[model samples]
Each structure stands twice: as C-alpha cells, then as structure tokens.
Target: MVGSSVEGLTFDENCQVLSVTAPAGASGLPVMVWFHGGAYVTGSGESTKYDASLLALEGVVVVSVSYRLGIFGYLRDNLGLLDQLVALRWVRDNIAAFGGDPSNVTAFGQSAGADSVYALMLVSDEPLFHRAILQSAPLGARGPERAEMTAALREFVSVDASTSVDDVLAVQKDALSMASARFSPSGGMPFGPVLGEIDLAPAASRIELLVGHTADDASPYVPDQPEAWEIATELVFAGPARQLAADWTTAGGQAATFDFRWRPANAPLGACHCMELPFLFDPAGWSHAGMLAGQEPDPVLAKTVRSLWTGFARNGMAALPSRSLELGE
Candidate 1:
C-alpha cells in the first residue's frame, strides 16, 4: 500500500498525517476514514488488524488516522472533541489527494473509536462526512460534560486550584505523563464526546445510522466473570440486554441493527467487539493472536460489509447485497 504524508496546516504541533493509497490511481473513489479503538488510550494508525489494502482494492480509498491518545487527547476541556473535529476537517481537505471523494467520506470506528464516530455525529453540524458506522458502542453517561472533564483534567494535571490556565498549559506534557501513568488506577481519563453543546451534540433525527453490538463483546474486556456480559449490556444498552432492540426502536433514528451472533467454529462466542474488523480488512498474514487468528478472507462477508459501508457513504443508507438481514427484521 503506497501512501503519503500531509502536514495539518491548522495545528502546527500535530503530527504529520499519513494516508494509504490504493493501487488504482487516486481519482474518484469514496474515502473511508477509520479511527482505531484502544479505550481512547492506546492503539495507533499502524495496527496490523486494520490493513486497508483490501478495502482499497475494492475501489475505495481507506485512511486510518492517528490521533493524540490517553491524556494527550482525551484529557481535555471537552473530552478531545476538538481533536477529532480537527482530524475530520483534515480528512475533508486532504483526502482528495489520495483518490478519495472529499464529499463522499465515511467515518467508521470500533469500541471507543465507535464512540468517537457517534460523538462526531452528535456534535458536528458541518456534516464533514456523508455517513457513519458505529460498532459495539452504546451511549454512556461519561461523555460531553466539559466542566466535569475540566475537573478531571485538574486532577490529571495535578494543578492546584489556584493555578493559572497558562501555568496548566505550560505543564501540560508533564501532567499528561503523570496522568497517563496514574490513569489506570484512577479509572482512566474520562474521555468521550461532550453533549448538548454544538461541538458534541447528539445526532438529529434525519441523520442516518448503523448501530449494533456483538453477542460476546463484554467477554474479552472483562473475562472470567459470569455477570460481566449482563453488566455490560445493562450499562451500555441502557437496560437488560434483551431490551436494546426496544430502546433503539424508541430512539427514532434511521438505523439498521445487527446482533452479529455468529462466532467462528473454534471460538466460543459469536462476534466479539473487534471481530468484524478482520472481515472488513482481510488481515491475511498478521499475527495478532487476540483477534486475527485463522481469519481467512470471507469474500461473501467482505463484499456484504464493504458494499453496505460504501453504499452508505454514497447514499446515507447501507443495503446488503445478499438481501437477507443478518439481524432480525
């Protein structure tokens, strides 16, 4: 996968942005900008599990982004909404160079990354992208409250209540380092989109959405607990796991929901949180033991997922070619 770097003009301190290109010359392909999931802390643009070459081969330009993670990104006034907004703005301006349609871009993410996509949809009225795909992420009470985040930031940075904002800014890096170290014990930085504000508001009724969860999503994150799945379902789905369908129905948004309950032959659970990625990216030789083992290319599932994604990017509605709904009708 050939690629190039573009420096973001607006933020001089930001890293040089990298975008992978398709073998087909950059001309008029739809762009898919991906955000990696690491609980908003770890992970990078260069994960082997997220190789976009397959999607690029399918006549779409795929760009995986690197954003400030952990304290650097999420320990902010507004839960790093500004950083994501900057990334979206950058994609809108520069993706055209890599054969992507700037006007036909889609934002896709998993886990915390999925939260970012929903946050972007909620906050941005500008419509930087045509559509969004959120995987295994449900609304949480932890997002979109700037003052709460600011207080957390103060604790994260270890600034005295009397410290000036300029002093806080001066010690930001040291604070970030300390905060990153202390994050896990303190339950990590409270990061996610801010709500009700213009920059991080909820999506309006007209916005199209594709939202779903895996049957065993909670297993990997919290292993060995019999009730982990139940807890996760209740916390994320906003009630019992069974009632998610009803909750989604009451939300009054245009969306297609999938259960993704089909696990592989050797796996115990169907469709864990990050399971759909290999099917999307076709990670052939990568050795990520947790998620990418024995993941052979499923042309049928790949075609279905990518076609739905691209179709949504083009028309704000994802239609599978198989004509069968993977989730219940």
Candidate 2:
C-alpha cells in the first residue's frame, strides 16, 4: 500500500494490503510475492523486517503482502489464506503495469507464511504463480480442527461485531492460551488455516518448488534440551520439508532443496529458524532482530544465495545441493 497503486483499486478496511518494489527503468521482470511469518499471530508486509528494496535491486519486481492475523484471520475461517489468494489475483492483473511479467511470478514465504503459501497452492484452482519458495515452513504444525477451535474459544469472552478491537484481542489471547494448552503437543497453532474443514487437493498444475529448512531450526525454542531441539526441528520444520520435496519429485515436478547451516559467529542459537532470511533480503532490514545475534550476513554468501533464488525464479532449474550449506566463520 505504500508503493504505487493502480487507479480505482481499493482494499477493504480489514487490512488486506500489499507493498511493491520495482527497479528503476525495468520492464517485464520476474515477480516475487512474499508472505511474512509470525506463527499466525504477528508480522506484516509493511514491517521494516520485510523491506524489499534490496531484493528489487536484483532486477526482479518484489511485492510483500499483508493479510489479517490472529482471530480475524483464522478463527471464523481461513480468511488469511483467502486474503493471500486475493492478493495473488491482484498481482496477476496489475503487476504488468509495474514492469513485471505476470506469467513469471513466484510465491514465497517463511514459517507460517510459508504454510499459507502451501495452503494457497492447495486451494487455488488456477496457477496464480509459476513457482513457490517455502523457507522453514512448519508443515508439521498444522492448524487444529474447527470444532477444537470452537471449544477453545468458549473458554474466553465472547465478542460481537460491535466489540472493540482491544477487547477482541484480549479475548483472542485467552482463547489462544486455551488452544495451545490443548494442541501444542501436536504442533498446532491457535489461529491459522484450519484442518478437516475442507477437502484439500493439489493445484491443477505441478508448481516448480524450492523447499528447505535451517539445520538447527528449533535450537532457540529448546536451547537447554538438545534432544528436544532435535526432535522439534525434525517434527516441525526439517522433516516435513524433506518429505514434501521428495513427494514433489516423485510426482514428476521440478524441485530443489537446501539445508542452511550457517550460524552467526558466537551466536548461541546456531542456524536456527529464520536464519536464511538475512541472506535473502537486505541484512540491514533485520539488524534489530536478536535472532541474527548482532552480526550481519556475509555479503558474499548473501549474494550467492540471492543469485541462486533469482536463477530458480527465472528458469526453475537451480539444483541446490541437498547437503548442508555452511559459511566460514
């Protein structure tokens, strides 16, 4: 919403928004649409953490999208995923005006955002984008069933259309507490795209896929429990990603996979969840994020990773190594 807009285009007041960044004097460039990750409770495309200017400088048109979060996005329905679908339709129609080739678009995300991208692919009837990049997607942390969510919500205060946003958020927090207590063992989110509500089938066409996870993605969450860290990482991030990539290939689709093992020097978390983000985007955008451990991404490595991403977007043929990728300290 902070970038150029098409005349007569308007978004509803529920905050379904997107921001665009295109290189100067560029035309017919590949487009990358991003969805942010925050366990389905936080994050937005407008946040400084997602600035796309550096990505656009790589000669692609970058669009960062924001959809509803928390109860508004998931409790009543999977509105967040629908909101992403709408954003994709918008890009399909208007991205050409921003010097993007609508036919050559990639949908990418991290964590919950990556899960949303996978959900979008399952529900979309048309090929809205040509490729997908799912980074650290918690494919194992699927949302709970509608009945379970309803039961959880019953433990909190009820709300009506007239309820204040603050009041609704307060109730939502309580509901999440209840839901997490009931579902955390299975890696379920309190509010996100729900399961067993709709029959999910693969998209009409096999999308080119690049799916991967960090080597020590769960270290931050269970730092004191090394065994728990390993189990959680495999159950929630790495294992599912590997299976998905394998299935995609078995289904005769082009797929690439990577395991990021580069940890910041002296960082306690190792190559934890979201560690790859700094390499994909501008390091400055993520400077204040404690996860990066006060270190900037290696410029040489960042360039290499971004180039690999761009190469995949251009032709869907970048065969990233299946082994762990490490950076020198």
Candidate 3:
C-alpha cells in the first residue's frame, strides 16, 4: 500500500484514502476507480475478489476506496451525497501523485457499486469521471423509498412505525449511536442512493459509458431459490428490463449490450448472476480455453469490451466495433 492523503476533505476521523499504483517502469498508466457491490448494505474496498494489482500491472493505476457503506455513509441527512462527492474530489486532486492521470479516470463498479456509478453520473453535474463501467446494474431501476427504509429501520429497532416522524428520527439517531458503540466502523448497512431530491440533477452526458447485465445477474444473490430466479429473470430481461434498455438508448449514449446465456450443459443451474465476473476478469485462463459449456471467451470479445473501456477513458466513444460478440451483427 502506497501511503498517501488528499486535501480539501473532511472524513469521519476513521476514514482514509487508499492509493495503489503499478510497479516501476510502468508509465502513463490509465486509472480505474473501483467500487465494490454488496447491495449498498455491505462490501468494502478491501475485498479479496477485487485485486487491482493485476490491472495495475496492465498499466493501470487502480484506486479501490473504503467509503461508508449502509447507514453510516448513506443515512441521507443531506450530507450523504457530499461525502461521496468529496471522495471523488480527493481522487481528482491527488491521484496524480501516484502516477495516475486523473483526467483519464474511469469509475467501475458491480451491483450496488454500479448503482453508485449511475448515481454519480446523474448527481455530479461537474463530472469528475471521464468514463464509467456499470456491470450487472442498469440505471433507473426502482430501489427502496425513504419512507419504506425508515419503516424498515423502525421495525429493526423494535419501534412502532406509527410513531411521529420526529420520534422516528430520534429512534434512528439512537440506533445509529448504539450501533457505533457495539461494532467497529466497518459494521453498517448502507441505504442505497436516492433519486429525485438529493440527486435531483440530470445525468452527465460528457462521460463515455459501458453498461450491461449478466444473463443470470441475480443468481448469486439468491442461489438455490428456483422460483426467485424465474421472477428475477422476468424482471431483468423481459419486463421492466426493456424500459431500462430504452432508457439507455434514449439518453443518446453509446453503449454495448450483451446477454451471456452460456450455461454448462451438465450443471442444473442456468446462467446466474456474477457469472460474468470471472469471465470479465478472465480468471483461471478461461479466456484462452473457454468454459465447460464450449462458450469460448473470444479475444475479439475481450478486446472489443476492454478496448471500449480503455478507449472511452482515452477518448469518449464506445468506438467502432472491431468484431461482434452477438450473432446479430
């Protein structure tokens, strides 16, 4: 870990900025700011799953952050968005010290992290990022409402939902205080981002973007629940899913979409969520040999995807496709 700090930010004493850089001789590396996903309720920059050292070796400076997750960072008390914005500000001002080109930063995330990427684009009109990659999360999806969230909190705290708003606020304050007393700073459930009021600003158009979902995105989240899987499939692919597709297109955005329905013939399970992660990271040399399903990870596919990502960070166009991943052309 390279020791560093950014200025013009006030973190809740426990929070600190972390920076990771490529080895020496690696010059002019692109920077990727990665955000982890755990339904906005869990997850951190320290997950073993996201090792940026590999990407750093690929000539990219990777900065994985430890933002307040759940209630601590997402309490929505008017300061929530400000807190996230400050983190981006830190990246903007200080990433250059670690050999990162701040101007060419791409924000990447999966699931709730992807949700944050979408929210950041919509809320931050100043546009701190040059490109964004949202995996397994589409924009404009319905999440929890504030009132519903409050009621859930009330139930968790064993308080009556019918209590006055001010009383409910008191309960929340006390609950947060008690939570702090018992657990370390890391223990907190993040309430997801809000839309209209706190994030009332329109989406940023200048940044290049890559947004898509896995063929079985919700698989990992609810594995072994067959009925749940069917419901999610309908929801994500057929039902409101089309609206999300239309929303992406209507935004005048350049995006590449893929449906990875490649399931192993022997495995009882279908294409479930998070199946794309290993493929995207191309772990276990699967990209070279292909998966058991005979679904090869085409270099053309990898190049097509990574080129769009890197090219977007370099220049804000998804770029002309060099090859096709889907059969339709």
lDDT of 1: 0.59
Q: Count the backbone clashes (under 3 Å) in each candidate.
A: 8, 0, 7
Q: Which candidate is the best by TM-score?
A: 2
Which pairs, if any, clash in model 1? 26-99, 122-201, 123-200, 123-201, 144-193, 144-194, 144-195, 263-270
**What TM-score, computed on C-alpha atoms, does each candidate reach?**
0.73, 0.88, 0.68
- Of the pair 1 and 2, which is ahead by TM-score? 2
Backbone clash total for model 1 is 8
Instruction: Kindly report which residue pairs in candidate 3 clash with one another.
Output: 70-189, 70-190, 71-189, 216-272, 216-273, 217-273, 219-273
Worst 10 residues of 1 by lDDT: 1-10
Better of 2 and 3 by lDDT: 2
In order of lDDT, best first, we have 2, 1, 3
Model 2: ten consecutive residues of lowest lDDT = 1-10
Best by lDDT: 2
Candidate 1 lDDT tens digits, 25-88:
7687877888777666555665566778777776778887767654446554553557667778
